[model samples]
Target: MQHEAKAARTVKEDRTDYLTEERYGHTAAHATMALTGTEWGVTTWNTRPRSVGRVTVCASNGPFAFQESISPVEARLIAQALLMAADDAEKAIDAAYVQDEVTA
Candidate 1:
């Protein structure tokens, strides 16, 4: 029983480390991408010690910011929504390019 408890603690610590590293990488990527004016950045950080996490979405150029404390389920939903929006944007841009090609 003692060994099991120790193993569980190790697992939790590893998970926490992974989450921290992931957040750091994301922040760095956002900083780089923001230079190109092509990406808005979302950053996640713990809001209440180890208990709660908040995700902040902000424009790369402007002062607009949106933040929310989200559960795992909500995070997944937001991820899906962002993916769909990106796909739509890509399609619109491709269509515009084709139209310009035909006009020229």
Candidate 2:
């Protein structure tokens, strides 16, 4: 099946068209450890339509030529999972340090 291409719309346009309340957004970039000269951007926007608040996450990797848009719920779930993973990573690091101290 051939997919129809829709006209690209900016975040501002999306907010203006769909959102009808307060807006909040944030963007950040991170360097990829797996590839040199690769950067990934994460942008989150708060959108509310008639009191139902939603979030949109846009991710892009220039070097990899990839982009994605994530819905509000999916973004929240992913964020929670990431936070848990980070906690686990920190615990592992602390354990390693404790082991080194015991050995030394």
Candidate 3:
């Protein structure tokens, strides 16, 4: 039916377009957590406009990163990505460290 097609199109468009307030919340959570160095599990919300949202990057040590008096969005992005990259990039720095630790 035409309605089904429209609904499908809507879903696709939401991916790129600016997400709604709800989408922002999830994005913020995902970004913050990723920055905190939880895991590499990244998710996409608001599938209409195709928003990549944010990437959560943790530190190499995996203790989570903390920042103070932050201004500008770029700073936030860098902070988050750097933290995640540090964590994600840790495999190269300490393969044994990762191997030694086991997750449930």
Task: List pairs with backbone clashes in candidate 2.
Answer: none
User: What would the C-alpha RMSD of candidate 1 be, to one decimal place?
Assistant: 11.6
Arrange candidates, best TM-score first. Answer: 2, 1, 3
The residue-by-residue lDDT of candidate 1 on 10-59, one tens digit each, is 12321222111124223222322324543344444444465446444444
lDDT of 3 by residue, 1-104 (tens): 11110111112333321111123223321221224433222223353233345322222326654323223375467659989999977867687667667541
lDDT of 2 by residue, 1-104 (tens): 12121223335533522212111332223323234434434444445443234444333355346655666687689889999999999999999999999999
Q: In what order do the candidates fall by lDDT, top score first?
A: 2, 1, 3
Off by over 4 Å in 1: 1-66
Q: After superposition, how far is residue 24 of candidate 1 from its true place, in Å?
A: 16
TM-score of 1: 0.47
**Alpha-carbon error at 27 in model 3, in Å?**
38
Cα TM-score of candidate 2: 0.50
- CA RMSD of each candidate after superposition: 11.6, 12.3, 13.2
| CA deviation > 4 Å runs, candidate 3 | 1-71, 96-104
